[model samples]
Target: MRFLLAIICCKLLRLALRLLGRGGTALPGQVALRICPDMLSRLSRGVRVAVVTGTNGKTTTCRMLEKMLRDAGEDCFANRSGSNLERGITADFVSNADIFGRPRRRLAVIECDEAAFRRVCGELAPAVCVVTNVFRDQLDRYGEVTHTLGAIREGLDRAAHATVCLNADCSLTASLAADAPDRVRFFGVDAPLGGAAAVSDAPRCIFCGAQYEYDYHTFAHLGGFRCPKCGYSRTEPDVAVVSVGALTSEGSAAEVRIDGELFDVAVGLPGGYNLYNAAAALSAATALGVERRSAVRSLAHMESGFGRMERFEIGGTRITMVLVKNPAGCDRAIDYLRSLSGECTAVFCLNDNAADGTDVSWIWDAGFERLFDAGGAELRLIVSGERADDMRLRLKYAGADEGDIRVLRSQDELLEAVTSAGGEVCILPTYTAMLPLRAALAARCGRKEFWK
Candidate 1:
């Protein structure tokens, strides 16, 4: 009776929120879980599930895997609303189930928050789990990167039956494979990207306290890393990018080796970090028994999910918005911005809300210095959101002229600034700030609301 009530209430609340023009991704599931605390476990039974959990690429990885499954004629649902917590995931499952708590679709792709993974993983008992690289993120909430890693490891402990897909390039992520050795599959880039290295989140070995030596670094702490003391090293990946081809502002093409067979894959997303996402998604798809060739073909047509390299156009201005949460992601966004040619305006929107992490100190660690150093196109600067002043100050410290930075505090001011800006525009916003700013951009451009 409680299960039935939970399902009915969740559906009704979702409908109510939709009618009220709200996303209704998390609250309905929260209410449903209150009515039945074990609702997720009960509802997830008899379903084939793949859960993607980590700091950076969870949502994109889930999106890619979900698309691969759908392209192969398997009906699957995911928490596409960017609500990755327990409540939001529960809401999605309930919405896809009937009043009797039976799933309409047997297959599901879920993106789980790292902190929530420990609590949600056992309940979902996913057939396949992918852990995209771990980096320092939400320090106020998760404390440290190691703590975030511990949370994911605990989640894996609960998911004994899962076929784990790990990033062989990330030392912190590769460490988790020890928990489920026989069932583990690895993916990574075989060649170095030859970019300037930023401060590494995992500078020393997780197993031993000794500093790590790199054969070459892709960016941040990822790439071929070897611990001199304990002799720990990167494992040979089952799926790897053997060579990188053309990388344009639109997308990237690479030669990938999947299970010893080479296939030229063109990813529909920009940035080298997305190559890791593609490899992770392909690893998860293969684990789920999806055809390798069909999954590889799906990467060429992947639509951007939410704020990850999402593009919009307003009044002759081409705008690209990338969500920046931590140093690693911020550095990658900066790399993408550097890749662009011609004149462009760069906007950094930051908020110190609870959801955005109260500590804005991570901005200091991000490579804002590289943006102003040299190279790239002619760039203009705009800072907005609740912490607009802080962003401006950070850019100043990164060697920007104080007069060149425009501080726009309100949404109206930001929208006006963006629309009036000349040439291409790139906006990087923290989590809480991205919501309203993206909404305003969508409204101005006639794009669909995020919920749709």
Candidate 2:
């Protein structure tokens, strides 16, 4: 009876919030948990859940996997609003359940926060868990990358029966396989990405204190890495991107080897980092029993979710908004900007709000200097949000001309600059800053509200 009451209350709260024109992704779950502490565990009892957690790419990978399940004619739901906390995850499960506390869908793709994974994973008891690569993110909240790794490892300890999908390129992520050797499945890119390595979040070996040697590097510390002292090396992935064909502004084309069968995969997203995400999604999908071909084909039709490579157009200008939180994600956004052929304007919106991480010092580690060096005179810069001046100063340090950098704090000012720019514009904003800006752009472009 308590479980049923919790479901009813959650549904009612969600309805009220929707009527009030709000997303209501987290609070409903928080209130429901207060009513029934074990609400997620009860609601997720019969569901076959697939949990995706890591520093980045969780949302994108979930979307891709959800699409794959749907294309295979399986009814599945995901936490699409980007509320990854325990409360938010519970809220999504409640929303997907009937008034009697029965799940309407048996398949779930949940994106969980790394810190919250310890509390939520055991409750959900997912069938497949995908740990997208780990990096230095939310230093104030998660402390260090190793701490984040420990949190995930603890979560995996609770869900022992779940098949773990590990990133073979990320030594920190691949280390989790030690706990679940028999159930581990690996995914990564095999070819070198051909760029000088950026600042590595995991430079030293996770198993040993020794420095790692790489035969080829994809980016950051992710690649063919081996510890000379401990003999810990990247294991051959079950799913791998053997070669990258093209990385255009539209998307990427690559040849992926999935369980010994090669398939030409086209991911409808920009940047090389997405290849890792694609491989992760395919790995998770196959683990969930979806056919390999159906899973591979779904990547080409993936729609960008929320602020992750979400696109909008106003009059003559086209704007792509990407949510940047950590150094690795920021560098990938810059790489996408550098790939543009003609004149382009890049906007960086940073906020030090709790959700965006109180410590904004991670920007110093990002490869912002590459933008000025590679883009040269073809790029225009705009900085906005609560920490616009800090971004402006950071750009100055990155070799951006002081005169070319525009600081537009107001939403009207930022929107006007985007509409008047008359070319392709890429706006990279942190978590909190992305909300209002994305809503404004969605309204102007006639796109549906993010909640819808």
Candidate 3:
């Protein structure tokens, strides 16, 4: 009775919140979990669930998985816009079920935080789990990348029967396979990405503490990585991006080999990191019993989720918003900026909110210097947010000319600058900062409100 009451109340609250133009991802779940502590597990029973947890790409990967499942004609739902915590996930489960607490959908794709995975998995015991990749993120929250890995390891240990999809190129993520080798599936790029590698988040082996050797580098630390001392190496991927045929600011095309089958894959999203997400999603789909061809076909139609490289047009300017929370993710966003073919306006938003690591020191670790150098003198830079001045200072040190740097402290000013920029505008904002900008843009541009 408590479970049913929790579900019904949370559903009504979610509806109420949506009607008020508010995002209903977390609070409803929080209230529901308080009403029934075991609500998540009760609601999750008998569902084929795929839980994706990692430092990055969880949302996009889950987006792909959900789409593939929907295309495969399965009744499915996901934690689309909510918090990715125990409570938020529970709330999502509640919302998908009937008032009697019976599931309307038999499949789910859940995006979970690394810190919350262990606690949540014990209840859900998902049929498939995908660890996108581990990076040094929110040091205040997760302590270290290894600690994040340990958390996921614990989750996998609890769900021993779940098919685990690991990233072969990421040493930190690939190491998890050792815990569940028989049930693990690997995904990664087959050949070198041919760029100077960014500073590796995992420079030493997780097991031996010895420096790693790479056959080639794709972007950050991801590549053909191998440990010499203990002989831990990247296993050949079951879902491999054999070659990226073309990568542009628009999208990317690649030849993806899934298991023993090869298919030409084209992702509608930009950036090389997105390629990894596509590969990871395909691997997870196959693990969840979706056909490989269907998964590959779905990849061609996948759109960017909320703030992970989402694009919009407003007031005559084209704006692409990419969310950056850590040094590695920031550097990748900067790399995407550096890849633009012509001059464009760049907006950098930094916030020290709790969701975005309180310690903003991670920005110093990104390749901002390289980004500024590549942008040349013509690039216009705008810094906005709670820490706009700090971002501006960081840019000045990154080789941005003083004359080209502008600071917009207000949302109206920032939006005006973006709309009046007269060309392609790229906005890179930290977690909290992205929220208001996304809301404002959506309101003016006729896009669906985040809650809806």
Candidate 4:
């Protein structure tokens, strides 16, 4: 009776919120959970589930995994709005089910928050679990990088039977396989990427306090990492990108060797980070028994999601929005902006909302200096959001000219500046700031809301 009531109430609340022009993905689930404490566990009883959680790339990994399942004639539902907490995931599961609390789709791909990973994973008992990578993120909320890793480890401790897909290149993520050695499937890049690496979130070994040695770095702290004192090293990935032939502003082309066979793969998303995401998705798909050929085919045409390198055109301007929450992610987004061809305007939006970590100090750790140094003809900078002044000051310290940096206070002013900008526009926004900017862009372009 409790389960039935929770589902009915959740559905009704979701309907009402949609009618009222709001995205109520999490609130309804929160209310439902209050009514039925075990509502998520109960509803997810008979379903085949794969939960993806980590510091970044959860949504993009879920997107590619969902496409793999759907393309192979399987019906699946996912939390597509980036509402990855316990409440939002519960809401998604409830809304996809019938009134009697039975899922219409037998399969699900869930993107989960790292902080909520332990509780949600224990409830779902997923058949497969994927951890993309971990970095220093939301220090105000999650404490430290080790705490985030411990949360994932605790979650995996509950689902002992699940197959784990991990990034072999990430020392933090690869360390999860220590306990469940036999059940882990590793994925990473095998070839060396040419360029300087970003500031590593994990410079010292988690197991041994000694500094890690890297044979080659793909980006950030991810690469062929080995702890000097403990002798902990990267395991050979079961799914590996043997070489990267082309990585442009449009997409990435690479050769992936999976299960002893090499296949050429193309990912529609841009950036070296996305190469890891593709490998993670493919590893999860294979763990779930999807054909490797079919899964690899889906990678060639995967579409970018909202605020993850999503592109739009309005009023003779092209806008690309990439969500950045932490130093590692911000640095990657800035690197992507540096890869653009013609003259472009770069907009950095920072918000101190509860969703985006209240502490705005992480901006100073990002590689804004590199972006400023790589400036080209007509390259401009615009700072907007609730903390636009803070971002402007940070850019100034990174060698950006105060005269060249324009600060726009409101969303309307930012939109107007974007529409009137004379070149391609690239936007870097924290989580909360991306929401309003996405809505305003959708309204102007007559596109559907991302959650729907």
Candidate 5:
């Protein structure tokens, strides 16, 4: 009865979402239960489930994984819109399915939120689990990075059988790798050019209390390193990304080596980090017996979803929207922008809500110094959010000048900040803050899906 009511509610809520011109993510999970009362029981029949959960990169990583599975000739059912919570996931299964509500797929790939991972994993036993990385996100909602990490450990414990795909780049994630030793497969990059910097990542050895040292620093709190005190370092990947293709408008290409064999491939996303992400996804698919070239071609054409490193055009300006929910994600966005040739206009939107976590202190951890420190063709630093002043202050300390930075409280003011910049708007926003920012950009730039 509960599940049935949940389904009915989903219908009503979905209409509301459509009317309001927003995504149906806020719909209660009970609606999912109402529609697919026996979702767990039904999944138990023969379907293999894989859950990807982390503070960052879960959506793109999961979407990439979905393409890998589909290329392997598997019927795929997934949360296609980045709805990774209980209610959102329930809606996914309930809304897109046949009346019987039975999934007709060989694989069910669900992107689980850091908070909802354990609940979803308990309800659907996944055979494979992937942890992209753990970064400080939503200091108010999550309190600390440790909380999200703990949730993942608990979720993994409930799974009947699982293979964990982990990023060797992140120290926080590498620490959690110990829980499942033999089952864990690690993937990462060699140090970038110049051999590495003096800055290190190992705050405390995840294995022993001894401080660890890094061979190189990839970005904020990510890299290949091992414990000097303990000896827990990044194990070599069974599958590794040898080279990344250009992150051009046409897409990307790469070379991946599996088991001492090389496979030249093309990937359709930007950034070197995405190379690592694609490698992780494909590596997981290989474990399921998928061929290399087919999966490579499929992923190369995989469409970029809205707001997750997605690109669009507004007037003459090329609008690139990046969802920066944490420090690591923000760092990567900065890195990508720095590499580009055109003048960069940044819209920094922050919000203090249950969804976005009121504590904006994590901005301090973000390497904003790298941005203001440069001060090149980048113009008009626009900062807007419920906590706009805080964001501005942080940037100020990072050496951003007061004259060049704009602080805005209202939505329209926020939009004006970017319009005033007179170049490509590189919009970077937090979790809940993105919806309104997207809407504003769409309205100003005349984008329908974004505005409505």
Candidate 6:
């Protein structure tokens, strides 16, 4: 009854949203109450669910999984708009249901929030659950990265029988391999260039409480290593990123050897970090029997969502918008930026909203060091949004020259600053700040390749 009511409410909300000239998310809470007053039990049908959860790359990873599934001729229902919570997931399932309240797809791919995994997973038992990584994020909301990792751990514990995809490169994720060895499949990137790059590493082990050694360090502490004391290390990736050859500011062209044949591909998204994401998705899809070549080709045509490594041409200059919500991601973005040369301007915006952590202190850990390491005087930083001052201070703390940093109180002004700054601007902002920045750039630049 609860599931049925929710389905009815979702239809009513869809109608109300259309009539009110708003998105489906604009519906009031009472509408859901009116429709779904009972428990949502429809999760137990023949419907298969696959959940992707992590700190930084959940959206991208989930997006890839969704596409691969669809390409494999599976009718899939996915949370493309990033409604990872109960409400968002419910809205998606409810709105996409048939007349009898059955889903229109053979499977579902949902991006579950790091902090809300247990709660959301409780509603839907996924046949496959992928944990991207547990990185330091939103300390105010989650306290520590462990809190988010704990949520995934809790879900994995309960759904012990589910096929678990863990990141062998991520220390925290690799640790889970020991706990649920029978159900977990570890996928990692063999960072052939790991020793040469300046990257961050995850510190201690969750089990034995000792520092894990790095055989190689991927970006921001994710890499090959093991704990000597407790023997916690990357336990042989089922799918390892064997080669991440050349990727420039323009895009990346590389090959991942799957089943002896190196599937040659070029991805529009910048960063080998993305290749890592693609590799993980490939592993999950292969586990589900998606054709390797079709999945490989499908990746080249992916559309950028929000500010997640999306590039566009503006005023005859090509600019890429990379969202940096935490230290690991910010570091990866900058590292990828260094992979190119040419004048690049950037807008760094922050928001301490509920979605963004109220504690803006996490910015300190974001390796603002990279912006400076790339050469301080060369890169000018435009700080914007509610936490503009915070961004400014963080840059200064990283020993950035005051002349190189400018703080703009308004998001609109940030765009104006970038336009007039004279270079290809790389807009780096948090989740809330990304849309407004995108809107402002789209208005003048008139780029629609990523608008939808």
Predicted candidate 5 versus true structure: per-residue lDDT over 1-452, tens digit per residue: 55445555665677678787666654645555656656644533466878888776788878888888877778888877666777777766655444454555667778888898888888777888888878767666776677888888888888758888888777778666678887887766554521113222336766576776777666555666788876888777766766655665445566777766888867788766677678678767776667766777677777666688776665567777888876667777776666566577887888877767666777887777777545444656888888889888988898888878877778777665555555677878887788766666666666666213
Model 1 CA lDDT for position 344: 90
> How far in Å is the alpha carbon of 295 misplaced in model 2?
0.9
Error of 5 at 125 (Å): 1.0
lDDT assessment of candidate 6: 0.72
Residue pairs of candidate 6 with colliding backbone atoms: 2-38, 5-35, 200-220, 200-221, 201-221, 226-233
Compared with the true structure, what per-residue lDDT tens digits does model 6 show for residues 1-452? 66566666677767676676555442432356355633233633667888888887888988888888888788887877656766666666665677467767768887888766886666677788888888778777776666777778887876655788888888877777666888777777776543223334357777887877777776776777778898766777776667777776555677676655667777666677887788778777876777888888878877666578776566665667898877778878777665556566766888878777688887776666665564433565778888888788888888778777888886557666776666667778787787667766766666652313
> Over 4 Å off in model 2, which ranges?
374-377
- lDDT by residue (1-452, candidate 2, tens digit) is 78878888888999999999999778899889999999899999999999999988999999999999999999999998888999989999988888888999999999999999988888999999999999888789889898999999999999878999999999999999998999999999999865447536988888778999998998788899999999999999999999999888789999999999999999998877889999999999999999999999999998887999998888889999999998988888877888887788999999999999989998998988888775443888899999998999999998888998999989899988988898899999998999998999899888888677
TM-score of 4: 0.97
lDDT of 3 by residue, 143-258 (tens): 98888889999999998779999999999999998888899999999877544486468999989999999888886898998999999998999999998888887788999999
Which 10 residues in a row give candidate 5 its minimum summed lDDT? 193-202
By lDDT: ranked, best first = 1, 2, 4, 3, 6, 5
lDDT accuracy of residue 105 in candidate 2: 95
TM per candidate comes to 0.98, 0.98, 0.97, 0.97, 0.88, 0.90
- Candidate 3: C-alpha RMSD after superposition: 1.4
- lDDT, candidate 3, at 288: 82
Q: Once superposed on the true structure, which residue ranges of model 5 sit more than 4 Å away at CA?
A: 1-22, 25-28, 32-45, 175-177, 193-202, 244-253, 374-376, 416-422, 440-452
Collision pairs in model 1: none
Worst 10 residues of 4 by lDDT: 191-200
